[model samples]
Target: MRCGIQSFFFLTLGGAETLLLTSMAYDCYVAICRPLHCHVRMGRRLCVLMVTGSWVMGSINSCALSIPYCQFRAINHFFCDVPTMVTLACMDTRVYDYMVFLSTILFFVLPLFGIVCSYSQVLLVVYRMSSAEGRWKTYSTCSAHLTVVTFYYSPFTYTYLQL
Candidate 1:
């Protein structure tokens, strides 16, 4: 019970972070690639919807943590996560393991792909800018976003996709 709760929250928070980063990447794409339409494309309602969607997807991913486990009481890791929980399972957890993998792909990998595509478009726009000032500004904005994505996703994907 305790492990399930811990894993659920951990996975949920991780999912939210991933989706939020993806959404930020998309925002950058719209701002840089379609500056005129960025306001309309990323309106207040759209921002709200994106946040809600992130949390919903996170909750769905965490739902896979509810598998039967052995009588083990200690988690090897600092916190209870899917990998640690899997190690505690007495039954064959291949299916659950696969589910975790699929969830990682869905919640982590797909968003990463989207982020890459978004930045690619942003880069193309930045490349064609008439003013060096504008180009530098765009690059500065994107570099910060990319840095955050790298710092957050590096450990996240490492932890979840190791399965």
Candidate 2:
């Protein structure tokens, strides 16, 4: 159905966006926390791998969620949310729901956890710095990243968990 296809498109786009943000966060983490080894740690090959993984994951998730919706034709929301559309289906959707849950855990929850852990470690090291200047510099570098992380994660959490 058109609605099903549209939903797949948007979810794919959203997933890709999340992946992009996550990759950027990883880059920032390396740059700030491992300045001397940034080049070696984030080489072109690794960057390519990260990006390819993101897209592949996003595509696979989108396809997995979309394939089961061949039975459903209507979409209630303004955007195509695979979960919502799955709920509207007349046929059994237990398997589809389970897959969506798994994908959500994999794509969103796990990445969020990684980002939090990475930032926590970075903060700990920054706070342990002996020099005030070093602390300030580290904090300054991390502040922007933290702000963006908060902005991205807050809404994502609210949407997926709280709300």
What TM-score does each of the candidates earn? 0.87, 0.81
lDDT per residue for candidate 2 within 58-156, as digits (tens), equals: 555554344554452656567766666667666687887787777878878887877777777787777778899988987887788778778877887
* Clashes (candidate 1): 0
Off by over 4 Å in 2: 64-74
- Candidate 1 residue 44 C-alpha distance from true site, Å: 5.4
How many clashes does each candidate structure show, in the order listed? 0, 0
lDDT of 1 by residue, 44-163 (tens): 887787677667655665554666655756766787677667767788878877877777777788999999999998888888889999999999989998999999988876776654
Q: Candidate 1 regions off by >4 Å?
A: 43-49, 63-65
lDDT of each: 0.78, 0.70
Clash pairs, candidate 2, are: none
Error of 2 at 137 (Å): 2.0
TM-score of 2: 0.81
Evaluate model 1: give its lDDT.
0.78
